[model samples]
Target: MSLNANDRSIAAFTMAGHALVHWFETSIPIFLVVWLAEFDVGVALFGVVVALGYAPFGLGALPGGILADRYGTRPLVLACLGGMSLAFLVLAAASSIYAIAAGLILWGIAASVYHPAGLALISTGVEDRGTVFAWHGIAGNAGIALGPFVAATLLIFLEWSVVAAVLAVPGVLAVLYGLGAEFDPTAAVADDADAGPDEALSPAALFSDSRTLFASAFAVVFVLVTFEGLYYRGTLTYLPEILHGLPAIESLALPAGLEGIQPADYIYVGLLVVGMAGQYAGGKLTNRIAPARGLAAIFAVLAVLALAFVPVTASGVGLAPIVALCGLLGFFLFAIQPFYQNAVAVFTPPDARGLSYGYTYLAEFGFGSASIALGGFVLGEFSQTVFFAMIAAFAGIGGLFAGALLVGGDRFAGTAETLEANADD
Candidate 1:
């Protein structure tokens, strides 16, 4: 796990970028509560508004991957940081729901490129890939936790608009750092005959590369991540809002200045803070175990947690048990990330690494984000039990796909690059 200079440099830059991405992403859920009150809209309508932003976050991953492959990770990474900062500034000036959606859409488009670019850079550049992935997840989890904490705290003093404008500062600083940061993006892959991304960006080449990718085990990983996305977005998007309604959270009180903060917001932040551990554990676990098995096991745990959510939250037993459940939920929710990310690397080639990650996230964020709308509708129309049940189903289905990979053994578990090397021999 000891990283040399290049690995450290890549890790530092990617970790900063990783944190910023989630900083913006996780903060939105906190904003959801505010948006609900300020916009005076029903949950279903507002959900669509959020989806307008999030859908593009997922939908744009493919082109982001293509651009990463064609142009290199640095430029896209820089653009992602710069664009996201500007998008939030746009949010600061928004006067209506439409303007908010426009700002979010811009943010999504800008932020969407980071994962494909950052992960691909690590997969190809960093020497200690799993270690870096662990650190990367930790950084993102930091943002996940801190973003809400900051937003919740700021909402105590400033308007949501000013808070968003304030949030833009870190990303702007990150961009300036990224501009001068140096590392060979292809360093680890340089020794391999097939390491570089494909040069051609033609439509036929794009189609062919995608076809070659889906013809392998990566296709299953894609489906698994989509379900991951569904469960993830569906559960987390309204979590603070959901928790705020809980008797456990509602009963709590804070001191004078902090009194404006919802007790549930703290719980939400606690859950995400615990995820940093889950992410690190998952990342380390990827090096020790089969990622497919890990994915299956983690998602199964998520299913059980999802099923337990309503029962636990509504039990009226007290804050301790609910807080514990949130802890477990936060942990396992993020633990699946590194497993699936490693699975992508195992199932695809270095040359197509960017596109593989692109498709992977497209399934995860793009298709998964639809659950935001679905969850909104479900929450609007049905009971909490039903919404959680839907989340359980997403987790169960994802677990099943991972189980298929486990059952397939080497036929599906073998790395694509290894098979290609063997075929060459």
Candidate 2:
């Protein structure tokens, strides 16, 4: 289908919004080491403080979805941008740990609104949703890649406070851009005329029939997302620190005034940069492949990669091999996003896309936040080997659920086709 100028504009704006949301959220990890040193807190305690931000980021999604449904997505998107910008400004001004926690809490609440509002806008507002979602995923991955690079680079020249304030600028600009943009909430549903009756129900009615939703394929998707979230939050929370300890990275030659920056920082950024391709590829696959099958394949690879990471790190392998491993790991880790996102759209009614995404993120991010502390505790008390093994297990479990989903989906499709055939008689 041909996209009009308005459609193109909305997609661009939405993608930009996606990038900013991720940039703000992921940048915090890059600062985690700094905070730990500055505050003299234990890793586990710091993890909890960070979770204060992330937990809200996930928990707030449901209400954010509900609000987006009641109010227009445009306003909620604007609020998210504006509020996040202000939250960073708060972070920049923070004088103590309490102030920092306060800033993170505000940031989390602000960030929470984005996924529900943004995904709902795309899933419901755009006609070329598969393509749009792909582009949106790319934008998010770009933010994930750049957040640390930008934050790390800025820290070289400025205080973390100034760096945070600088980061807030994009959100301010997005807020301004959104104010002038035009969008049609009904455009998304209109594009899919055959949407089921359940798709058209309000949130309350949808909840009333929650049993039907859970009984269907969506429940399996939910389980897969939860495990995926745990893996994501667990591994990524301390990746930079993990990389920092690698002896190979410490020996790399560096330029003057850049000596303080670890090689792992550069590698971390590069790995995420590679994830953009994975996001694009995954998006394209969603158009051709069944979501559950795609998820199972990707998660299986992720499971293997997660298990291999510790071995590669401990092998005394050169920097190149480790970097290559990280690159592959990054690709599979992010590639799963678009597939599962598409899965949610496939399994749920179009009208409830917001709610579906809301719950999806709640599983991915809200419950996912627990891993931050868990990882910290694991690392502090045990070892990296155990941590990697745990992450591998999470991915493996997710893959199993995805496989089950594939089987269940096939059975359901067969049953539906048979019922339709009988009705025609």
The prediction achieving the highest TM-score against the true structure is 1
Clashes of each: 0, 1
Worst 10 residues of 2 by lDDT: 415-424
Q: Candidate 2 versus the native: TM-score?
A: 0.86
lDDT for model 2: 0.80
Per-residue lDDT, model 1, residue 206, is 71
lDDT of each residue in 63-110, candidate 2, tens digit only: 777667556577788899999999999989987888889989999999
Superposed Cα deviation of residue 294, candidate 2 (Å): 0.7
Poorest stretch of ten by lDDT in candidate 1: 416-425
Looking at model 2, the pairs that clash are 124-188
Question: Each model's C-alpha lDDT?
Answer: 0.86, 0.80
